[model samples]
Target: MQDRDDAITPGWVADLAEIGELVSGAYGHYVERMEMLPGPMRTDYAVPLAAGQIEVLRADGRIAGLLVLVPEPEHMLLDNVAVAPWAQGRGFGRRLMDHAEARARAAGYDRITLYTHVTMVENIEIYLRRGYVETHRAEVNGLHRVYMAKRLG
Candidate 1:
């Protein structure tokens, strides 16, 4: 496992684009089967470093993952999260989640919420193991999206 103490730096939007391509290619079958829209795989929606928001992670001098937080009235939304193809199966994703939770708590936020396609069972299990609980569900892009929440307080 990569050490969490290792330095994690900000990743640029350009890097995120590249990461998105890699992720899309790796998960293209699911994306196509689910009939996702043809456009940018990763959408940049939040301002960088705003209100406990961040969008990048570079671990040990390498692009490790992407994390975007959108501040909300009651909690922060974990809008986007992706681990690099080379870094998958490691603890990097968990480290990113831990970092996000710590930041949200320090920002006085009481909860963290996110939604992911139900077909992404591995992701659901990961979040569940990390203390997230399913809060709702809906069908989007021909796939079931399960919304989850984790209290940070």
Candidate 2:
């Protein structure tokens, strides 16, 4: 996995457009499916980019996806993850999640937490299959979300 902190460069500012495109392309279709913009679709990645929390995945020398991981006192938060629409079905999303869990473990974290919109049942199922358990459900920021966590062994 690329060290997000070490990977930042002056070029990152220029790459924002490509990063935004990947994120939007990944989540844009959900806007209609969910009847509102999905959280990722509305996000401005500059915040996370500036915080050194955004990790990029590349394929064929092109940005194929991104992952945002935030370390909390108690757990590492897998804040956001997305693969470009054209890049889906290539296992990039799974690889990114694995990187998040590995990073959490390397960072001395025993647990990792994440949430998805309640309307994204597929994501919830994928998390479940990967050993994440539903911790709770709540409405946050005008979105009904389902939170989940996994214990690192």
Clashes of each: 0, 0
**Residue lDDT tens for model 2, 1-153:** 333432222226556899889978887877887898888877888998888888887775667778888889999999998888887898888888888899999999999999999989889999999999999999977889999999999
lDDT for position 146 in model 1: 90
What C-alpha lDDT does candidate 2 achieve relative to the native structure? Answer: 0.84
Against the reference, the lDDT scores of all candidates come to 0.69, 0.84
lDDT of 1 at 48: 52
Output the worst ten-in-a-row residue range by lDDT, candidate 1: 37-46
The candidate maximizing TM-score is 2
TM-score of each: 0.76, 0.90
Lowest lDDT block of 10, candidate 2: 2-11
Residue 145 lDDT, candidate 2, scale 0-100: 93
